[model samples]
Target: MRFRGLLLGLFLLPAVVGAYLLAGSATEDGTPRCDGIIEEYGDAERSGPMKPGETCDLYDFADGRSQGTRSYDQQRKAQEAKASKDGLVGGVCLVYGLAGACAVIAGRRAAPAPPGSRRRPETAPRSRRGGQAPPIGSMSTRTGVPHTRSTS
Candidate 1:
């Protein structure tokens, strides 16, 4: 049974590792780079905490940068989720498969005896007087009861 369990574990080990590798491979990020710039307020008047008639170039560089960043983040999160799910699946298969295999092996090896098959030899019934049983067909030592053979 132990040998069988070992063999089963060895067989499942490769599958478990393969599952992990596949999950890792599935998490590759492919988002494009953010290079373009948006000029939302070109030479526009400055509004806050500045002298009157002040002008500034309020270029919105972050808008274009955030697009690629957001996409990359979303893809990264999706990849992580998929990797986690696959890892969980692989772990469950590894643990439960090995445990179930071991249990089945042990069950088969320790199967119960068939009906009417004697597992142990029958023994003489003990006396209630708390000593060795009296001989067959003899009276009890203390209670004076006659001993009889059991029908079981």
Candidate 2:
């Protein structure tokens, strides 16, 4: 059983690493963007207003002018959804890694002796007379038993 656990842990190690890598790859950049229509006010000296659904920095909307738009709400929801997904993936990977570590540690522990293979230490039999007891089937008997011939 211990050997089996060791093998299982070894096999799971590679899988856990692979899973962690995969999760890492799926993660998005830490940049938060506006998913709604960005309406930027600019004069002839600057570029025109941002197009619909264009990525915009959250700082641009810090003035609170566009906070009530549907685009802002959509951006917030998207960010929240991504955060939840990332958290879940990280949690799963952590749990898997912990389980694999436990399995390896448990497998390394000493195995128990097989049934009937253990030997008990030899001990002398107990006697009421405080001496070694007689051999089995001897004429001498225990005090509790009545002898066929009476001492009288």
Candidate 3:
């Protein structure tokens, strides 16, 4: 039984170690897909082919500007509509955010703090000696001495 268990473990060790070694190095390559728009592939027009290191990005006139790879022939109209809608929605969100920020600034400047609401409180001073604040103990651990707090 012991030898059988040993043999099983030895067989599994390489697989386990290999899995660990591979787990740390796995990465995804994000390549923009060109599909649906063009069924048959053909050479790009006089615009020339994209450079070796270059990526494609379709232009969005409504969105103002964009940078990335884009396809014209195979590209669908829906993508354009979606991109425009996304930009409009993003603009609205930015306007709301700016309004909220302005409101916060105006409120801080115009509104007064509530009456008698203390903002800062005095803090206790630290002892110059770098040691634990002596415990308020009644009986000393080393000697049987009673500790007391002076009121006078």
Between the candidate structures 1 and 3, which one is better when assessed by TM-score?
1
Q: Looking at model 3, report the run of 10 residues with the lowest lDDT sum.
A: 24-33
TM-score of 2: 0.35
Give the TM-scores of the predictions, in the order they appear. 0.34, 0.35, 0.31
- Model 3 error, position 42 (Å): 16
* Deviation of model 1 at 91, angstroms: 2.2
- Model 2 stretches astray by more than 4 angstroms: 1-39, 43-70, 111-152
Q: Candidate 1, residues 1-152: lDDT per residue as tens digits?
A: 46666766775675576566556646544432223322225643322222223222333465633333223344345556766677677766656655765766677678776678878976755565566656789886567788887989
Candidate 2 residues 7-41, lDDT tens each?
Answer: 76675765676566556646744444554344455
Top candidate, metric TM-score: 2
Ranking of predictions according to TM-score:
2, 1, 3
Candidate 1 to truth, TM:
0.34
Model 3 lDDT per residue over 35-122, tens place: 2122223554223333333334544556756434455432333344544555555555545544554555565568666668866765
Using lDDT as the measure, the top candidate is 2
